[model samples]
Target: MSATTDGSRVRNLWDEAKAATLDEPGKLLYRSNLLGSDKRITNYGGGNTSAKVTHRDPLTGEDVTVLWVKGSGGDVGTIKLDGFATLYMDKLNRLRDIYRGPAHEDEMVGYLPHCTFNLNPRAASIDTPLHAYLPYPHVDHMHPDAVIAIAATRNGREITRRVYGEEIGWLEWRRPGFELGLELARFAAENPEAKGVVLGSHGLFTWGRTAEECYATTLAIINRAIEWFEGELKDKPAFGGEVVAALPRERRREIAARLMPEIRARIGRDEAKIGHFDDSDAVLQFVGSAALRPLAALGTSCPDHFLRTKIRPLVLDFDPANGDVEALVAGLDGAVEAYRQDYAAYYQRSKHPDSPAMRDPNAVIYLVPGVGMISFAKDKGTARVSAEFYVNAINVMRGASGVDDYLGLPEQEAFDIEYWLLEEAKLQRLPKPKPLAGRVALVTGGAGGIGQAIAARLMAEGACVVLADIDANALDATKADFAKGFGADQVRGTRMNVTSEAEVAASFAEAVVEYGGLDILVSNAGIASAAPVEDTTLEVWDRNISILATGYFLVSREAFRLFRRQKLGGSMIFISSKNGLAASAGASAYCTAKAAEIHLARCLALEGAEAGIRVNTVNPDAVLRGSKIWSGEWREQRAASSKIGTEELEAHYRNRSLLKRSVFPEDIAEAVYFFASDLSAKSTGNIVNVDAGNAISFTR
Candidate 1:
């Protein structure tokens, strides 16, 4: 144990962990989970772990030494026994002997796959050789923020000597490959008593006789580095900028909202990109700082971060003094284009001959001064992850800067890691993305069961969503809930009373600001009413018409206006009721309003044809399992009107449909997704009934 070690704590955890897992790989998995669970040690999948073990070789009938290295693309936090690629140590050592002069990136990558002991298809990490070359039985390598703070500093070597003396070996900047492996092994041999190796401008490496020892050594090294940094860099500088305090928070949100949609559009997939603003104090400090551009230009804290954040963040210049939307959009367009050009140049200058196709040119992160930072990705999940990684990088850079000047690998070196075949393999493994990759959508009554379902579906298919509803509490709660799954950047909530033109107009304007522009609008804010035509009062009928009929008109009218402005052919889907097409007894007001909403959609379709806007309707009946529309009087009235108990009435509706299944919110959401995507590109002004195959509800 070193200076930072807490032996009792490590011993206790190890005792508990080892008691649960008697197998070696299982024990290694437990250790990996412990390391990965701490974000400070590794962000997302930025690190790897390994152990040396013996396994029976079926062909030779003898125990062989195997290198159990973490598999490529697996997060150590949740990695399982299978997540480790079992490699033959002797074969890996043989390949190392033949690695001569300059190590070829592709050759090393190719050899890794075939060197596995069990012919395991899982790709070993690119750093497998580095781990294999180590003499210890257990090894842990990580890019902890504290370690990067020192490694990325100007005086990294001197700092390393001052901290660990001859106990740690330091290697100059060498890209992760066979060469790095050789250099680290040579350094270890030269200094027999060295506790670990600190890769210059790279990361930390530690080894021990056992997994527990190695794990403890890593924590000790990290704690010492962090302690040294805190002691030496006592006075941290405050973040300052030309306009950090000059701009208002509201303006920052407005600018981010306005600029994001266009930025997403310029990146050029059909659906809009999801944008997240990291406006926390730390984020604001870094993004708003005067040194942001220069510090950000140094590149990511480590090369591994390049996978999630790219070489650098996209920084945009914006001022609230001038509010020309097009000009702002054009500026974002130019910046995005410049970023792509830079990426191409970076690729051409340093890419290996065998490197895979260049990754998406768009920067995953965008640094907005007044608005903090906005991260973008093809989907909500990635966008959030990118934001998290960037935030961590920002803090690391800040800490590094507090001491000696912060530094990272040169551009060419970073490009080598960014385009490494092993890294590219991770993206290739993802399932084909949804077609609506760059679209933004708005769902009214989003707090309702059907609206929530629609928002979930839209996000699942790669669209950012704005949830608008009159119930402020419900809207906020739903937004928070959805954000956990879809990302906070992709999901937002706005209080909107659809019947009021002012509220509708404001909500649409907010959508335009928040998402840059709108692509899909779901006019689903309506209430259910049931009464005989003679018994219907003006209050009941007007209330129903105002919500079901006029609400659709107001919302659609605003959406159409914004769609024309953006000139991106959009979709407007109305969630009318099955009662609209097939009148239900004693439900005169609800039926009439629903019928009017359907006709309104048709009229809008005709009007929007030239503008490339497609309007369609989804007629769903009795989506009552979670629907707010079926509560209290409406449910009782409908059951009484049908001359049956509530349960029997529900059963009658279920059996009435040809499919004999209840029409649920999810079923309607699936139909909505169809119209929103390219599947209904040529089809508009049509009503798709989602009432469990109810023939009577169908409309041509």
Candidate 2:
């Protein structure tokens, strides 16, 4: 098996489940987990698995056979037993007879819920009937990269026969439904000796009497396909050396940063869209191939991919090694227009009158030679998913090109799955997303308590976040936490000292190059300082001014520069303190610097209004929970000045406010979110106080 499949891990998981006296459904759960864990086999929520088991009929009190199959909206890798939809095999198989001619997609789908036998209310996968028609007790269906490499080729059927011989049966392209299920049943009847079946321009299906047997067979078959594909590619150049060599990493990112914003505008202007640049070796190699332009335009390797990635990716002509922004944007504008025009025509010709209208005609995957690939979507997770599918597709195509010509399902079949009611239901099921969906935000000092809280909130609202922090350790920890909660790719970390002009400029440049462009800039990097004017030294004053005042200026300055260049209105938020508006004894330096930061925001707000840029400040007080400044002797001295215990300071401040509530980091974050979001579109040059109704700190 390929390195992707870990037989030992699967065995151990199954063994542990058996030791716990797990049922057939539990075994199927482990089997699905093993297969789905391998991206080479299946992407997120892309495959289905099932096990035939005997259960006592609810009313009859008699043992009856049912198929426990992976349910819709569940990714097999992490799915639990509850994620499987149980259906009586007899009732599911009966659908094959009831629908004989044309695919009654809607009728077949509607019948599935009625046939469901389990108490679990979740809908079964659309491929449930296919599992029922199979004779084996366990079934595994996955869109493996290697099988797709051959299955999506011109000579796919011939290649399947050549590799697997009679061990595997080959079926022509068909949109999965009752008709396809019936066809598979017929093939099984004819080829009872076959261990698996390969569907053209679709994926592979394997079955056995046990979960282990089914999973093993899947890996064995995929391995043979991969081996054959590799053998065929022997001595191939892989990727043209000259093309990849032409674009250095920095140059590629520079071009990508400038290009993504224009692409987003061309695709849709109403909402912010996110872009992910995939310049990994595999992607770059594939994109730089001599066969790229011709083969890539053919379509996705499998019909399932057509939903996330379109039938074909939009290929741009601009070279990453040497391309001007204007020229690149011009080329992208033409390409985007052409792709949409062609998609509109395709939909008109192939779509049913009652089918869902066309989705955004925007291309999901953008293929740029030398620069690699970029996947665009309304959010980071989907963008990363699209990129993953395309990266795998490129490899499959590369391998297929060696054996035969790459071929995807015809345009009509793609349309069938693209607009399928089953697929549409998944999208409809998702709750209305937050308005920040697809927007990119950069939170400076993002690894701190307040910064981390703000970054988390922004990401929760569907914005892709870049955590820019001077502390490397905190930056990495926060990045990891965000990755686990959201996704590994949605949140990125950058080590930046905002006071350094070079670092600020480079960080903004890198942000553009890496994430396309920034939509929100939270200039919140600052250090707290406290001293009476008479006691304040040059060192204390400089330290406070450098980070609290100068730091905000440098970061905000870079943000404005990028915002103007992209021609996109943006938001800049400064995390000032209530001390900026109202003075406290022994806090001269800190108070004066924060006051400077607020004034700077006003200056930027005035200059930025013409560029659609909005600048604002969130003045928070006594947010000491996550404040590093409130630690050690500084915290003790500040508490001593108030003649209270250090821990009592929070409550003290809360009581001091009219609302009698302690101001938390998250309270400040909410204020920043308001400025960053469209809620404050008409409001700028403002200060929103988050001090729990402190009269002295109230914004004037």
Per-model TM-score, in order, reads: 0.86, 0.93
In model 1, what lDDT does residue 598 have?
87
Model 2 CA lDDT for position 198: 94
| lDDT agreement with native, every candidate | 0.80, 0.82
lDDT of 1 by residue, 1-700 (tens): 1111253122224565453666767778878888877677777777889999999997898999999999887888878888889898888989966675564555777777777787787778778988998888888988888788778888888888888888777877887778877777888788879889888777889888877788878877877777777777666564334445435777777666666666655664643565556677778888767788898888885776766788898887755456454676677757888999998888888877788877678888888765677777666566677777887787678777887788866887787777766657766777886776667899999999999999999988878889999999999899999989876767878899999999887787677655557889998887887888999999999999999999999999888877775677789999998888988788899899999998999999999999999999999988887788886687888888878888787788898789898888899999999999989999899998888887777675
Q: Give lDDT tens digits, candidate 2, residues 339-417.
A: 9899899889999977897888878899887787888887777788888888878778777777677786688878888
| Model 2 worst lDDT window (10 residues) | 1-10
Error (Å) of candidate 1 at residue 281 is 2.5
Off by over 4 Å in 2: 1-21, 239-246, 320-326, 643-648
Residue pairs that clash (backbone atoms under 3 angstroms), model 2: none
